[model samples]
Target: MSRVRHREAVFYDYFRQSTKIIVQAAELFDRIVGEWPSSKPLIPQMKELETRHDELTGSVIDELNRSFITPFDRGDIYSLISLLDGIVDGLEGVSARFDIYGVNEMVQSTRQMSGLILQCAHELDTLFEHFENFKRDGVVLEKVKRVSDLEDEGDLVYRRALGEVFSSSADPVHVLKWKSLLDKTEDALDNCKHVTNVVHSVVMKNA
Candidate 1:
């Protein structure tokens, strides 16, 4: 292989690895939400994923510092990695809160949002693959739109969930705890959208 191809491969691999971590985090989130009310603490699993993501982020930054040419602009690469990491961080925060609040049962709204978050992440997995071909490929644009649509769905679910909590729950403390947890879940979904936007922005700038 030529030296130039090898260098470009490094950038591709870094983006792929970063997306894998985000996907893994999303899967873990689905698991935690599925096994909600379990006796075990799920925060540890999230913490592990978050730690791995941080290490990957650092490696990407190190590579960026060393490389003279990148597949995309240096700023865009950094922004994409950081935003992807933020998604994991946000997911980890929600898991930690679940443990801290001693949440024994998962509400339907939370469950619904979790599913949407997973779907959005899955769309991103496809979206990232087209990064190098962003200028001409229309499929990447479709994936971006799908992620954006899912984010809107997440927002709807979040609003309905909050309304349900307020109208039905008589305990103020319970309401407070669930509200905070739901808000964190929404935040994680927003992070996913942010990742999608970064991909879209890179395409637009280069198109």
Candidate 2:
């Protein structure tokens, strides 16, 4: 491959690597929610993944600065990595909150939300896997739409979960804690959607 093509490939590689980490974090979060107090032991693992992802993010930006030619717009590349990093950051924050709030039992809605985030992360992984071919592969757009659909489903789940938190909990503290958790979880899903939006834009612009 020519030097420019090789540089493009590097950006795609960074994207794939970043998404892989996101999926790992999502799976870990799912397990943590599924196992609740027992899962407290896994929070550090999630934090480690977050730190790993941050390092990768810095590497991508460093690459972007060093190269003259890129796979796409510099701004889009930066936005994509920043948003990808946000997903993990949001997850790590939520995981840390479970410990900070001294949460004992798991909320059903929180678990459900975590499951949704995991599904979205998997879709994102698939999306990035196919992203390099966005110009020729129609599947790229389909993956973009899939992430958006999952985000829409997440919206419903978030609303219902928030309602449940408010209506069912007698203690205001419990409501506050779970509400914060749900908001962060939902934000993670939203970040996934934002990444797809960037992908979709890059595809359209290149077309």
Write model 1 residue lDDT over 124-158, tens digit each, in one string. 88887876677898988999899899999999999
Root-mean-square deviation of each candidate, in angstroms?
1.6, 0.9
Model 2 accuracy (lDDT, Cα): 0.92
What does candidate 2's lDDT look like per residue over 38-131, in tens digits?
9999999999999999999999899999999988899999999899999999999999999999999887877888888899899889888988
- Model 1 off-target regions past 4 Å? 39-41
Q: Candidate 1's C-alpha lDDT?
A: 0.85
Best by TM-score: 2
